[model samples]
Each structure stands twice: as C-alpha cells, then as structure tokens.
Target: MVSCPFAVSCWNKSFPGSQSIHTQVLEVWLEKMFGKYSDNKYADIVTLCWALWRARNDVVWEKKYSRVNRVIASAKQYLLRWKCAPVTCSSVLFRFVVEEDGAITWVRPTRNSIKVTVDATLFAERREYGLGIVARDADGLLVEAKIKCYSGTVTVEYVEALGIKEALSWIKNKGWQEVKLESDCLAVVQAIRCTVEMQSSFGQVVADCRRELRDSNSISLLFIKRSANVVTHCFARASHRYPDRTFDWSDIPIEFQDCIQMESI
Candidate 1:
C-alpha cells in the first residue's frame, strides 16, 4: 500500500517521511511509523490504512477505483464518526463532550486568559495557501481576527505548520500573556509539545514554534476538533478574498458574522 502511487500521494500530504519509508513488510513500516511519531497521529495513520485497504478491496472484488481525495475523505469521515461515538463509561476521562448533533463546540478559556484559534487552507488551483487566526477572550468575545495568503505548492502539514508559526509570531508581537492557543492539527501540536527533534520538511517551522512556546511560560498549545474551530476554518476558507494578506476587523465581514455568532452561542 505504501508503494502505490495513489497511496504515496496521500501519505506524503499528511506524513512527511512517507516517501522515504522503505520496508518490504507493511506491519514493519507501521511499527516504525508508530515508534517514530507522536501518539496523536496514531489514529490518523490507522484510519488511512483502513481506507487504503478498503479501496484496494473495492478494486479487487468490485472492479472499482477510488481517487486519492475520496480515500482521504473516507478516512476522515470514519475518524470523525469514531470521535463522535458516545462514551457510556463514567470512568473514562474525555476532554470533549459530544453534543446531540455529535459536534464539539468551541470552549472558553480560563478566567483572565485569551484563546487563539488558527487554521490553514490550501488553494490548489491558485497554487497558494491561506491562514486564519481568531482571538477570543475568556467570555468568548472576539478580540481580533487576521488572515494571510501565501503563494506556494506545499503539503497540508507544511501549511498547517506555517499557520501555527504565524499565530505564535502574531501573539508575541502583541505581547499577549496567559494565552491558550488552539489548532486542529494534532501532528503539529504534538511535534511542538514534544522535546524530541523533528526531522521532517516542516521541522524548522516546528522548531520556531517550540522556541516561541519555550520563551513564553504563560502560553499553552492544545488540539481541538475541527468542529470547535469553525470560526478560524471559515476565515481560512475566505482568505482568498483578502489579497492584501491582512484583515482589519474594525468592521467584521458579512460572511464571517454568522461564524463568529455561532461560536459565541
């Protein structure tokens, strides 16, 4: 599965060293990946494996083919369903409580602290990427919002890393303290939180993020579900509208008003 051109593209988009992974046995490769990476990415890798296996079976038994995007989407849909499953056991400690609609809502930060959500979106047709950042106070009131666009043909992880780095730099410039930074990119979050050296293509960006975190004892980085990060996700999706690469939120855009209100609710 790793050697297949279609699977390779999906792996490379999510995992940086997937192209160089050389092993005759699939189990051996999985073992190596699990050992080399953080725990947060384990679910994603396993889900992708299942998706690829299902695709292969379809091709073999039903004479059907699945595109890379469909395979990736299938994996994500499965993962989301798994996450939305209700936890009946009272002893289990879960950070998020799945709602009736199975969507996790944005959480407010601790008193006197601010929460910053960041997300990145890729425009493949335009050969560019956009980043969105939104800051809200402990009461969930919007303090500021920003979006930036950069021209490049990079992997999803790379752009995600860039979004995080930009968020940290922006926070540092504002001299914000007691900040709770949130992102849906679990791999990037784990990479920054862990002390182990990152040797991937975005290692430098991760290093910069780590440096920023190390310098600020009051700031903490955590992972949240994409459902809870809808505001920033919307901003990232609408980033192409702002070619100047910066947004002035003195007057909030009409398109973003609903997203901002939803989070507040």
Candidate 2:
C-alpha cells in the first residue's frame, strides 16, 4: 500500500496496504513469528516506513485501513523487541497533551526549511561508504532525514568529504540560506575551511557544495564528536545492509522510515 510515486520503486508497488497492516497485526498476534523476526526489518523496507506507519497512523487514508493506534503499537513492539517502548517521539506526539498559553509554541509538522547536520563515513571493516543528513527546526525537532549507500568503495577521508558535500547540497536544494554543517570527520572540516582538495570523486562533491553554498553568507561548517552524530551511525549500519538503491525515496523500503525517525531523535 506504499504507493505514491515513491512506492513504485519499492520491490512491488501493487502489494496490498491492508495486507501490510494485516502482517503487522499478525506479527504482534503470533508470538512465534514475532520471536523469529529480529528487527521487523523487511529487506525491501528500510526501517523508515515502520516509523511513518507508527507516528503518522492517525493520518488515515480511506475507510479500509488498519487501526491507527494498533499499527503504532505493533511497530513499536516490533522495533523495541519488547511488548512496548517506554516513550518515543511518536508516542509523545500521539499521547501528550498540554494547554500552554493558548499559543502553539512548537509542533513537528512536516517542515519547509530547517537547519541541518550531515555525516558521512566509510566503514573500515567493509570499505563501503555511508551518507546521512538530518533537518531540524529552530526548536530542534526533526523534519526530514535521509541516508543512502554511497556508490563504489571509497576511502575514509573521501566519505567524510562526501558527507559534508551532501549536507550542503541538501540545504541548497531546500533553499536554505544559513546552515550550520557539522561532521565528525576532521578531514571534512579541513576540506571545507582549509580549502584542501579532497580525493577526486569526493572533491567534486565538495567543490559543488562550496560553489552552491558559497554564494550564501549564512552557511558555516563545524566539527563534532562522532558520538554526537548518531543519525549517520545508523545510516552507516544501514549502508552495510542495503548497499545500494535508486536515489529516489520511492526506490527505498519502509524500514528507512525508522532510520529517519531515529536520526531526528
């Protein structure tokens, strides 16, 4: 049922949405199947859909959809590997209610423009590259996030360079004027601030971002501890699992929805 231009590229577009919901319920109902499932991550879905289905379940389609609340619980149960999670962004959004000053201070609605951070790393274990970028609002709520398998095996420095470039590209495309780019890769900081030419492939990305972002006076780059960049860590793990897919989100599986959520958190 994940058909929206983005759904077609996912293994099969015609797959039943109701069936997906049914499968979710059955996994919760059947302790055996649930036990067998490690992460509830179908290779076709990239952990992202698991979240969208959970957090946004109330945003329904037609009358023939799964119970929104159950879907959220099932997704949480499946992901947490426990009967339930203590609390998550989705859970808070769905359950929390506060009356504050008749004025809505913050909301996590789909964002239009936001400040962002990006990280790219190449696993020394496999030599594969990973890229992830996350957009956050002024209040630090996540808007949209993405991770992808970088094409071809690459060097560590190059992956870091590519990560910064990708982050800049993301902001520019979104028409963001001032972005505070951060990365754990020291090489990336050197590449941007020091103007040292990176490896050829990564250099191209860096060059592109420099050109695109340079025109803006608001953009700046910073270096952060790797532990601070958790989204990219998840993304790096994901790059190892689903090494390659089309660039479009439609081509990715549902599991990635969780990755996006995790990054935001």
Candidate 3:
C-alpha cells in the first residue's frame, strides 16, 4: 500500500483514526479495520479493497485519475445493490465520514510565529536522497522553500536528521528566533528530543541535530502526521528530480502550486 500513492490519501480521508495507522503495512491495516468494525464489516472491507485496487489499476494502465471518494461511494453502492447483510450497531460505532478536500492538507502556524517544515525521502536502490525545507508565517504564507540532494550511502533516518540540522541552519540564518521545526518522521523527532537514541551511526547525526537545535532560541521541534506535511513531502520528492535547486516563495515551480493551493483552503 505504501507504494500506491492513492492508498495513503484515500484511507486517511475515508476513515477515522487513520492518521495513527495509515503508515502500517497492508496486512496490519486490514486486521485493524476488520477488528474495529467486525459486525458484518467483512463484506464492506472486501468491497473497499476491490474498489481501491481497481481504481489504482485504472490510473496505472489507462492514465486516468480516479478520485478515492468516488471509488468508495461506488463500493458502498455495489454492496447495497447486492443486498449485502446490513451493518449493525458495532459497525455504526466505527463509521467514518469522508473528508471533502482529502487528507494531505496544510495547517497554520502559531500566531506571530514562523513554522519550518522539513522532510526527507530516500531512494535506496539508486543511493539517492533528497531533503525539503519550507517555512511559512502564521498566516500560512510561504516564506521560503529549498530542495537538496545527497548522493551517498545513507538511511532515511540519517536523511531526516540532516533535514532537521540543515533546516535549523537555514532558519538561524534567516534570523527567525521564535519558530517551530516540524517533521513527519516520529522516530527522528523523538530522538532529537532525547527521548530515544539510535544505536547505529545515525545516532551521531541525531546528536549533531540536537546540538545544533540547542543553540537556537525559541525553536520548537515537533512531529506532525504526514497528511499535514504534504508540501514538504512533495518538495522532498521534487529534490530527487531537481537536485540542489532553491525556490523562493515567488519562484517555486508550477508543480508545487497544486499542493499549495490544496493546503491554502
């Protein structure tokens, strides 16, 4: 499911409690879903999975986009038309309302403060890595955005640590004292907070990030769900394509516009 771009956003929008478990593997997700909605939910889940798979295949093979909501609605319609067993009170307890704008949307920063969001993506097979850092004001206006690349041996954790360190340096250089440094990687965020430490060489990177963060004034390191950090995720993927490119608020490329627009709402 991780390989399917639509799966993450679909589950997040169509189901409640998705933020905590969307990152789980497919089997675990299915297990949790069924466990939570066991009262005649088997048929519902079966229909949902079939719909999503067919929707994904349509995009992959026919070059057509399929909205997740439409697919889910079709699945439900099919179940009703086929006279499937009715869902019970137990299933009602787990019902989730679909989000209209999808899940990967932006969030505002604290009042009178700056928010710096960073993300990193690794392509292990190619030994390539990319980092994205974006800053926005309290009103959610873009302050700056940067994309960086590294062609060396590194893990995703190390790349995330690097993202924190580099983003801090950029923030410090910009003279933003009261700021929030956010990332989607929970392990790295906890490691930076000194709550946990990696035993591998990546531990040193975390240490360096902590030391760098310690010198910053009024900077808060936070972990956010991936859904709320879509802009950074998009930029991280962009960095792999355009290595070492820097885009200011006015100069950001056209591809970023859609995600930014989605979040602005």
TM-score of each: 0.62, 0.47, 0.60
- The C-alpha stretches of model 2 lying farther than 4 A from their native spots are 1-113, 123-127, 196-199, 240-265
Q: Across residues 1-265, which tens digit of lDDT does each residue of candidate 2 receive?
A: 2443332323133223323332434345234323444554342243335544443444555433333323442343344333223434454454322221111111222334355556766666665677777666665555556677755677777777776776776677777755666666665565665567666786777777677667777676665545345544555567666554323344444554444443333
Q: List the residue pairs that clash in candidate 1.
A: none
**Per-candidate local distance difference test:** 0.80, 0.52, 0.74
Better of 2 and 3 by lDDT: 3
| lDDT (Cα) of model 2 | 0.52
Error of 1 at 209 (Å): 0.6
Higher-TM-score candidate of 2 and 3: 3
Q: How far is candidate 1 from the true structure (C-alpha RMSD, Å)?
A: 13.6
The predictions' CA RMSDs to the true structure, in order, are 13.6, 11.7, 13.0
Which ranges of candidate 3 are over 4 A from the true structure?
Answer: 1-105, 195-200
TM-score, cand. 1: 0.62
